[model samples]
Target: MTTARRIPVAIVGGFLGSGKTSLLRRVLTGAADTAVIVNEFGEVGLDHQLLRACEERVELLGGGCACCTRRADLVRTLRDLLDDRDRGRAELRRVVIETSGLADPAPIAFTITSDPMVRHHFEVERLIVTVDACNGPAQLAAHPEVAKQALLADELVITKVDLVEPEARDRLAAQLSELNPAATIRTAVHGVLEHEALRASAGRAEPGARPDGRAPPPPARAGAGGHTDDVRTLCMDLDRPIDWLGFAVWLSMLLHARGEEVLRVKGLLELEDGTLVSVNGVQHVMHTPEHLPRAAIADPRPGIVFITRGLDVHRLRDSLETFQRLARAGAGVSGR
Candidate 1:
């Protein structure tokens, strides 16, 4: 008989004071079955203690950041969870790792995909980052780490909007848009975000995307962008499907030419052959692309989204458009 497969893992990351803890608390309380791994139990101990009565599977690594110092512990903990699932002792179906504010998500993601023992049992479902609406712009300007966190996210959540004025909220949202254009950002009140929307923003497969109740599509507007320090981000949309080989060549060239200046790039793209592909990049290094089974009636088109620091958007856009056009024209025509 075959053993039951372990579920996917979700990494929740953000800058300091970015409401990651609040969001975790809400998810822990609401989720039916889950296991959480945090740096220290005491860090968010109050909330953890409050939810202890939920009878959920919980594990805490008390010493260091899960991505760096405590990485071994993380591997061990996840292995144990898999063991339990195989033994029918625990009904653990998902895992969430709330990373430290200073953590870099790329290394953590790399570890998840590359670790032999953990890789077989679990896959990375999504990278979610929360931005504090009040301090987001200033943090982005003053800190490079803040930009890095936002760059790695599949979805960006703009938290604490009610703390500021209406106009300030709009400006904050705008800034988030400019810094990480590829991410899907939305406002939340306390921890009562539309779980389905947040999950959908991350992607269709990750936890929190499907709540028990019905949900509406998020407002059809581009996310807001904030200006911090000298760094900036630009977000754009492309309605056409991309040529797979051309896209590969174009991405490689772009990374070689301007990778150092790029912070992150994430998007859900449609290949010319009618398949959906999820792509993400941090600086010049990109993780392997994850392809989804094609939906019979869904449109296949490229949705270009980018997050760059100290790069020119107009020039970049022009270059991308030109390459896209050229790539389309040359595809399947043989070598030049």
Candidate 2:
């Protein structure tokens, strides 16, 4: 039996009136072999109408959010899309899901990675979230869902920058960086972004590193302006190589215990075997680790950034250290 090709999926998410549709319209312009799935929370869906001009295969899930009431529909839609491709009914090289403004993208990601049939044929490429520059700060502070959306995104696009003053835009960008230090932040005017801005590779520059391969200044700590939630960013830099087995155990236990609190975790680590591995996860769902070339990462030291809610960073660090020590001791016993 021939193995089926897996399709790449990108998720576009943000809060209400955050310009998700505008960004989707920009993304689909002149792009071929791409299928779009739009989820709107109201009974009367309208975003699909705006997107139809650019895409031929537009699937709409109306009256429900993709992360909650309509998740099953999402899975069914994805399966049908795959079936169509196999039957030569649609030319689908990529799939983009434009989630409702009020949707939390974590569940959508969890669904894609957890469903056996869907996981076999589809993989999440990246999550792109839009923030309304004029209202982002207030929205982020008032809405925990909005904060979660920003925290879990791989790429964050601040839209309507033209409406905000330069100082305001810069402040919002800085705040978002603190919320998600690992995410790549870009500004969009009138929902238009450079073609390359949305590409996965554009944000591949290692977090905390500048384009010139130098480490940038550290961002201010999270928890400013009375965020109303416990969300914060915790960064850890390890001087020694990680024991994969121990690190895995620590992470598994952490997520199993407090998956919802642990919003997002991402980092690069040098293993005891001298291999560099990139690790990323959203809530309880973890992506398969990818091996990387040392030259690709500007920093020699291994580091991880955790975006968590109501979790103590000190306790987390200690727990991980204890697990690593135990793992190394066990390895020594086995070798002896």
Specify the highest-lDDT model's number. Answer: 2
Return the TM-score for candidate 2, rounded to 2 decimals: 0.83
Q: What is the lDDT of residue 5 in candidate 2?
A: 63
Give the Cα error of residue 151 in candidate 2, in Å.
Answer: 1.1
Model 1: residues >4 Å from true position, as ranges?
1-6, 30-32, 46-70, 194-241, 249-261, 283-288, 292-301, 310-336
List, residue by residue over 290-335, the lDDT tens digit for candidate 2.
7777776555556777778788877887888899899999999999
Q: Quote model 1's TM-score.
A: 0.70
Scored by lDDT, model 1 comes in at: 0.63
Worst 10 residues of 2 by lDDT: 49-58
86 Cα displacement, candidate 1 (Å):
2.6
| Per-residue lDDT over 18-106 for candidate 1, one digit per residue giving the tens place of the 0 to 100 score | 88888887778856468777777666543532122111122322232222222555676777777876788666778888777877766
Cα deviation of 96, candidate 1, in Å = 0.9
Number of backbone collisions per candidate, in order?
15, 0
Record all residue pairs in model 2 with backbone atoms less than 3 Å apart, i.e. clashing.
Answer: none
TM-score of each: 0.70, 0.83
